[model samples]
Target: MTDSDIGYLTPVIDEDGAPFWQYAARGQLRIQACASCDELRFPPRPCCPRCRSFDSTWRRMSGRGRIWSYVLPHPPLLPGYAEQAPYNAVVVELADAPRIRLVGNVVAAADAPLDSVDPELLSVGAPVRVAFTAASGGVTVPRWLLER
Candidate 1:
């Protein structure tokens, strides 16, 4: 199957994560920060995990990070993902917030196919920068690209 034949999955936008997707659509990466403790958190929650405060705010991120870990799914676990076998799924540790890690794919360009990056080139601790891709259904996804 071709890349066009396989559709990208849209993230489930809830009250806590709605701002994240909204910021991504605008080409800015924002994560939840605790208003009370000034702690940054990912996979946004209504309450701060650090201080248990219900008050939180959105903070723009540097979008610079390093690959903490990665995997090449050989037998693609999902239906659409099977078409993009050998693609790298990476866990990136943010430069400014080392404790905040995000999971995404590393591609050659913003809109490049999932398999654009060679799996051999990916390594733990490799520097990467964020890039956004507008997928089907008007959803924008944050992807990573190797930093030269």
Candidate 2:
């Protein structure tokens, strides 16, 4: 099946996470940070857990990370992704922000197919970098690439 036919689900953008998608569209990896305590946060929310402040700003990251963990699914959870079964779904721990982690697929290139990389190459603590791809509805999703 073609990449278009793989039908990856588009993210559900909300007020709290809008800026993230915006930055991703521009090929930048940004995380929400607390203006009060200087703490970085993921799954961006309005309030800062450390300072109990509602103030926050977007911080650009190095776009560098390491695979904290990964899995290759069989009999894909969604029928639309079945053709891409065995793709690597990875949990990446950001290099700059150790406390934050993000889940995404690891592909050979920015816009490559989900299963483009061999599953055997995946491992915990492997270095990776962030990549982005435009999705349906003007949203951009982050993908990962192994650091050479």
TM-score winner: 2
Clashing pairs in 2: none
lDDT, candidate 1, equals: 0.89
Per-residue alpha-carbon lDDT of candidate 2 for residues 1-148, written as tens digits (9 for 90 to 100): 1234346676777899999999999999999999999999999999998888999999999999999989888778677678887787899999999889999999999889889999888899999999998876667889999997
- Please give the distance, in angstroms, between residue 116's alpha carbon in candidate 2 and its true position after superposition: 0.2
lDDT of each residue in 1-148, candidate 1, tens digit only: 1233345566767889989999999999998999999999988998887789999999998999999999998788677788877788899999989999999999999999899999989999999999999976677889999998
RMSD of 2: 3.1
Count of steric clashes across candidates, in order: 0, 0
Model 1, total clashes? 0
Candidate 1 minimal-lDDT segment of 10 residues: 1-10
Off by over 4 Å in 1: 1-7
